[model samples]
Target: MSSAPVIGVAVLLVKGETVLLGRRRSSVGHNTYALPGGHLEFGESFEECAVREVKEETGLDIKDIEFVTVTNDVFTEAAKPLHLVAVFMRAHLADPDQLPQNMEPEKCYGWDWYNWKNLPQPLFRPLETMLKNGFSPFSTELN
Candidate 1:
């Protein structure tokens, strides 16, 4: 395996007190709740990747994309050790009336809004690492 860590961009699609998340069916974090995001592509900015991934995965357009934080996630305990640099971003729906659809059913079960204070169990590692480090997506200042 390549020694370099992969860069992942995860968007915290905020709506009031809730954020958009879906049950992942991917190899990295199977059966875990994850934000709308994916691997960053060549020459792609973080904001661009967030928007593109959200649209491609959930069929929703996002705006106000801002960098929140980054996590160095090293999954050393996995059957195949993996390392990822997860860049977290905060954004909102471009249209409030728009709803998220399961655009890639093969990758996610479906999208849903969940209260940040009471998120679903078994969060994806990067997200779980963020929460454990006291990162909150709601406030004007990083929490």
Candidate 2:
């Protein structure tokens, strides 16, 4: 039996021309950095998923949610074939004073802000797809 692609909601929390990202330590995309996001739960809207995932992973409140872009990611290196439909969205921290914390240290190293032009190495595949397609949170341009 074939399974459908998993839908994930990735949040682009931009402030001061930088965005929030975390180094993942899980089975998928281990040691690679990606935006703070997670699998979209049932009965949740895109914006709702974005807010929940950020809060779950970074303990940060986000606002000004807006649609960005979607990337179809496919990975077959793992035991089971994995595919993801990543929904990218732009948002800002509701409280500027709140810093991103590694709410789940077991799953992530920590969170930090990085310039769009100077992202950390070994980015997650979905994020790479975003960049390859010219998706920049700093600018409203996406190709």
Highest TM-score: give the candidate number: 1
Model 2: per-residue Cα lDDT over 103-142, one tens digit each: 9999999999998889999999999999999777877564
Highest lDDT, which number? 1
Write candidate 1's Cα lDDT for 1-143 as tens digits: 54899999999999999999999987778899999999999999999999999999988999999999999988876667789999999999999999999999999999999998999999999999999998899877975
Clashing pairs in 1: none
TM-score between candidate 2 and the true structure: 0.95
TM-score for each model: 0.95, 0.95
For model 1, the superposed segments whose C-alpha errors exceed 4 Å read: none
Model 2 CA lDDT for position 132? 95
- Summed over model 1, clashes come to 0
Worst 10 residues of 1 by lDDT: 73-82
Instruction: Go through the candidates in order and give each one's C-alpha lDDT.
Output: 0.93, 0.91
